[model samples]
Target chain A: MSEPLESTLKPGDSYVQSFARGLSVIRAFSAEAPRQTLTEVAKRCGLTRAGARRILLTLETLGYVKADGRLFALTPKILDLGFAYLSSQPLWQFAEPVMQQLAGELKESCSAAVLEGGDIVYVLRVPARKIMSINLGVGSRLPAWCTSMGRVLLAGLPPAELEEQLARVQFHSHTARTARNLDELRTRIAQVRSQGWCLINQELEEGLVSLAAPIVDRNGQTIAALNVGAQVNRTPPEALLEQCLPRLLEAAQSISRLLQIKS
Target chain B: MSEPLESTLKPGDSYVQSFARGLSVIRAFSAEAPRQTLTEVAKRCGLTRAGARRILLTLETLGYVKADGRLFALTPKILDLGFAYLSSQPLWQFAEPVMQQLAGELKESCSAAVLEGGDIVYVLRVPARKIMSINLGVGSRLPAWCTSMGRVLLAGLPPAELEEQLARVQFHSHTARTARNLDELRTRIAQVRSQGWCLINQELEEGLVSLAAPIVDRNGQTIAALNVGAQVNRTPPEALLEQCLPRLLEAAQSISRLLQIKS
Candidate 1:
């Protein structure tokens, strides 16, 4: 759940309170609550009924949201906002074909993500088959501490920044193999940094195994992480490392080269 | 280009000016200008530098926009806004596998889109291979008058709504094959409405042919359109109709059935 509008921030001169409230209203509508009444939106966003009403009306006027009698839902135009980010960043376009090839070669799912705050946000995903209970796609987020892509992305950050991000992580043990503490995570990320790839065995979810490599920019800075994931029953961790790791690294490097040429 | 912020709307009690301006600022950054200085953002958004600055700063503070020295660019967090729409609308989730199967079977790209204004915005896409010069993905927009999916979506609207949308379209002859005027488009849309499907022969772009069918809700009201597109040289219009049409209609009907069952 997003922090309620009231306690999250005090309206400052530079801050647009109405804009913040509008975003809060948008965020309040999730998969769990796809449709909401005015009162539901108001309560969830921590806005006065009138404030939520105005924001919702404004969104309706903009064609981003529509009302079905008493309930409001986002329209497809809401996608243009996200496409702006994807279209602007050329990296994903460069990564997609490479990731698709990797997925095809390995007969698994491949994904690329960039580190954002304490999480990794998927930017590109090419699935050979569905391997996880969670349906992840572009824009889906996962905890950086447990996900293979997340760890590779974290490994790219400067030590001080990495430590800062790690400190902020509200670690949850998703599986028995998840790193137990900050120190353990730090050690894992260090291993990734030195090895140029990271493999996680059922840390994010049971029966899931994934290997990830960094896609670096012209300056050798890791801009994104590429990953391939499979079910453990179908492909054991050792098999994954032996069969997929080399190809995953090659794909990542190919994308990195493209980024360098473009940049 | 979006209308300049100043003349677009009068700020009423229900209209959130800051929120509108924020959206304008976000739209100002596109493929042409992915990164811009504060002055450029202000000029493009038709806002004073201070107004643009505040929004940019607030966006940066919110982690949606990042500053690279003097330039401001959107970060991947902006995708969360788009993902909210995708995640909430169960339609796309239901459409993906069906569209993928259609694309695989037809050996062509299959897509599903919803009509937003005079454009069809892609909601789900499964590409067999890259065929179009323009790289299209989810959230990409194509003019309704020239696209098979767009015509089917337009056919869904009430007569008055369709006319109103048609009047707003800045008709461009993308190719000689595109519908010449409002009357021609109206006839085409009417044909789609009665025939239950639409096929465009290189109307949007030369050598591109596509066939589209409607995805309807429980009420048999068209909610979206699904399409299969291929190069004209590879798949002639007659082949598309005779060979691909039955399968396209079947795939679309399958999705509509799923929607009815779920709804």
Candidate 2:
């Protein structure tokens, strides 16, 4: 596939040839393939090995990648690039306190997540004590349809865009309880919208349940969703709806207020 | 002065071209100027407005930046880029547990930092309880001369390279106690090497004291440094040395062992 538009052009104008290639090499590393040989990178990125070598060498010189013998993997220094983004974005800053207070008050694992294509990516996560079996962290991602956070975000999308996304998604069974068809997904999203929140039971993985509410900005656009997950053994759907939804919406609104002030 | 190498390249290597520019734009947004105008970006990066615009437009399209009317600022989505780096680096994965334990034991803010030019950029930070006045989270950068983390990371450099960094640094005081001469910096780094740790007092900011130790991989290269910080009122230097050094070294060794095992 051709590279996405944002990954290709500056905005309207000039191109710096070598620099773009270097960025492409960094992007090639992902969750499944954390490290890549030069030839592997070349094949994945459609670049020659020598071209990839120049980019890697440049990144290595900049302290972004460490090259041992022949294999190339990213160095922790690359976090500076990501840190540069996070430290500047006001959403995480605004969400931090609200999520912490709500999570502490509720005694559940609370998180704030944003949409990333067909996945929901966790930006802020406050893990509950008593050792939950799931090892979800701040940067972890999961399929949208299988998560409460994802469903809330999807429900906020325009009808046309949501339909297009539903069409594109391959509905795999993450758990027996996961929504596996477009019809079911559409119904669930509609219900979530009507109820002003979503409560998902064992959809992502067995034994886990989550409730999510949309966080809207001044424009009333859902930029993110705030969710709380509990082990189903501890809190069933009834308790979740009655107790968690009110708190979740309150926290989401608090975060949204903070974001508006920041903007 | 010219556009950074990562922001250039052509469409035939489209992945390479776009990735570099995207990375460069992320780099452009720093703590010094979290929000930047197009002209500022162009001038800082040595790009024409036309060149910078294409990259910015691409970034906007990807939902990494929100160009609120005219002023462009990053959105939380950009954290994905940095998270990509941290999630992949095994050193962080290994070091986090030890760092967390050390922080718990000491009741102080502990960080694992690596050197970048004249600054020390934090790759990992386990913050202290009791609420610090300053909100120095992960990814924040501090001057190397005044910070214990920076001194330990600087000790990794060869003597000549160390001297070069000192010469380039404009030693402005963040606090009255900060070092301002090349000789003082040399002496401090040499002392850090000899002692196998660094303890800096109120150099970066008044009342901020930190103890740091170097972390070496199996190759015996100083890949990173670990530090714990608190108010001088909380833990005096004598108590810190007596109580913290042994645990810090133990934590460093644990990280080193993990790095070697993973490698």
Candidate 3:
């Protein structure tokens, strides 16, 4: 009863808890913790040393993880998992050209992200310039509540689900303009929902400004959020909305059509 | 003894075989077949229908695999595994700026790839132009023996290992200039190893010309191969070597230094 739903697997359920634990072990190694000893992996994954060691060895045997006789890190083959998703997504094949054209027209970096927990994971990106301090690749993540993509994604959820998600967020203010609590965040999300888009000014970072629009399916359900980020001085929030919003909305609409067609 | 090494679990072994099979099932779904029925998945993975059903259901429960109540496909959450690897790679973070600069200087698409099985998986890329008909992303793989990056990676391997790998290659005539046999491939790879770079003209595709150099470590091991790909019309092979090879080699050396420093 006390355990998190994330780790619970029923015994008679025909599911392997160890399998899930192995994936959790893989997830434990992040950008911040690129390499770790057995002890650290165990602690981070809430597993015994024996359990973590076994999974690490198995991954090493399969050429997915490499251990330099002591420390364990993921091998390049692990990128195959991300590749499977990118290749399978009819959405990306449809969205890439559209996003490329938008980025070309606006002369800005555009991306497509989905809300996963309290973060937005970039599923597709077309870069015009490297403006942000962070190195954003396809699999990069940013805080969901603060980023324009995050807000647009959150705005898509049902009220109770959104509240439940918001309840889980442990917000530490990133900037002076960052949302302080649930009330402020809820207000921001509501505005995004009403306007069918979102814009953030110096919230994710000092000089970064972004505008995002919702990619909705045939039923008007949001599957993902599309965004274009630019430096504050080069393109203000109002200018972003005035100039890029129409193209962004148009791109999102085409993606939605493609997804529906695939369905 | 009859059991395949891939699926065989040792008695009292701590490694979870089910976890590996679960990933194999996920991998079985690809760009060609994004969704599969339980029977199809079992056939592809060499598992019983009941066994495949169990694993698919487990993934569905964990929110990694989404089912349409009939067919199974991966959800966005499947991306986390890829994100884990991309985030952990200090190499890509270091290589991006280097690749970006090289791409800018040469006006070509620069990439980094590693040898995995008989393929070269792209680990990082910066495109100056869309020269290929196929979409090249962070995880896209091309035949190792045919690509400049692939030859460089194969050249990095030990003599015996390289021979073993080349023996396994099912060499298809990809182009007019494609390597005819293992002896030819070995000769090409040998030259690449001695010269510290490779240039391939119209081997992988029509009009696709590329040059590659090895990104070595402190131990003088080639961890990855860096390359620049241009069109035949815009940049002839000799001109490519004359203009871009120096910068490409310089980029590879700097990336090697960064890896050594990180270690």
Candidate 4:
């Protein structure tokens, strides 16, 4: 019997070269460009037209895409990609109702997020209203250390991993309030851990103030965090902490209990 | 300097092997298994453990995945995969609020959906209450012929493509009410086109009655369908047609106007 020699890869190592390239093609679609011609996709993904055509065609055949004459775009069926993740990811299910409740209670956009390398990937975002200036919708991502959720999640990381993660990214000042020094970031994370909450005042964006609290499982390990954000004019940092923090903490506790109940 | 090769892929083919394999790995994560050990992934993807490991690790490095010890799971960052579709797909933006408002006004779930081959995938689903038996979330797919939205979408499809799609799937009945014959389906679609709407008594599930109207863009081409679903007891078929049809049609018109509005 002959066996296919699957490439040997270490933990966290790269594998399946074609797969990575294919993903690049998919990633080429953005808020600005949802529908693209084959030439645009090829240019975006750095693939030859023939190469892009193959992937797009295969994807179309697989029902992940819908081709409209010369234009190629993803269909709603493509949502199955993320749907598969949300259906399987227990944290999203647990965080959903809590985020919804938090959004209603705070009258602000409340979201649950986890740190992914340099970004805070929003798992669940219960938006408060339409015409949000931030435009950070569910499935949107922002630099982790720059946001309240990122600070809280970073605070929860083990020392070695935390250091490793910090080392990987070149800390640059995004706003005047953003911490540019590693020592300062370390101190900030320590404060966040000790305080059991993190507040980013105009760090990510001026006029966008947010407060966050860590969500820990029964094991006391922080798996996720809840963050509430609003415009600075609508709710100042003082009001956010005073009015929203208690309810946020309660929701976080309830989410923790739910996670434990499932486990 | 050598010019880059243009990627000209046919509808039936793919060019980037790595991209295909990578996407297949991403697709491998589903409702049944969100997280998997390296060995499990290898088995599911038909790759050697080493091959799977590299892909998984690379994904992890890319911030799309996270590994806790031996088990790996997709990160919420993965929603970027679908969010890309939602944010870029211009039709849903116009339809989302209209669908939500219609759901509220009608006191039933309202959705905007497009057809995908033999399936009707929900692009936007506005829920009535927090709890429903069907987790018919956005991006969820159901067999099209059995659904009002599906039927409407099929009615819009060119006859040749419709025939091809019909010939492909085994008309397995989801419920006793499901139409089992291809001829009956064709007739139903034609009637839906002629009548401007489709009503399914309980084709997909018992007691689930739905009324749907086509959502056409300014070009008057059916891009998707707007539908309302409720318990059979809540609204008799005749009443649903009388009461809900106008609202559905009105909402559909509003959405069309919104899509055509200059941003």
Candidate 3 TM-score restricted to chain A:
0.87
Chain B TM-score against the true chain B, each candidate: 0.92, 0.82, 0.89, 0.90
**CA error at residue B176 for candidate 1, angstroms:** 1.3
State how far residue A255 of model 1 sits from its true place (Å): 0.9
Better of 1 and 4 by TM-score: 1
Cα lDDT of model 4 by residue, A121-234, tens digit = 777765563435354556778888778999899899899988888887677777898887888888888999898998889977789999999888888999888989889998
lDDT of each: 0.83, 0.76, 0.83, 0.76
Report the error of model 2 at residue B30, Å: 5.0
Model 2 Cα shift for residue B141 (angstroms):
1.8
Which one is best on TM-score?
A: 1
Q: What is candidate 4's CA lDDT for residue B135?
A: 54
Interface DockQ of candidate 3? 0.44
- Candidate whose DockQ is highest: 1
TM-score ranking, best first: 1, 3, 4, 2
Better of 3 and 4 by DockQ: 3
Which docking band does candidate 1 fall into? Answer: acceptable
TM-score of model 1 (CA atoms):
0.93
lDDT for each residue of candidate 1 in B33-146, tens digit (9 for 90 to 100): 899988899999999977788788778767789988788999888988999988988887777777767776777878899988788999877666333323587888988878
What's each prediction's TM-score? 0.93, 0.83, 0.90, 0.84
- Candidates arranged by lDDT, highest first: 1, 3, 4, 2
Q: For residues B160-195, what per-residue lDDT tens digits would candidate 3 score against the true structure?
A: 988788889998888999998888888998999899
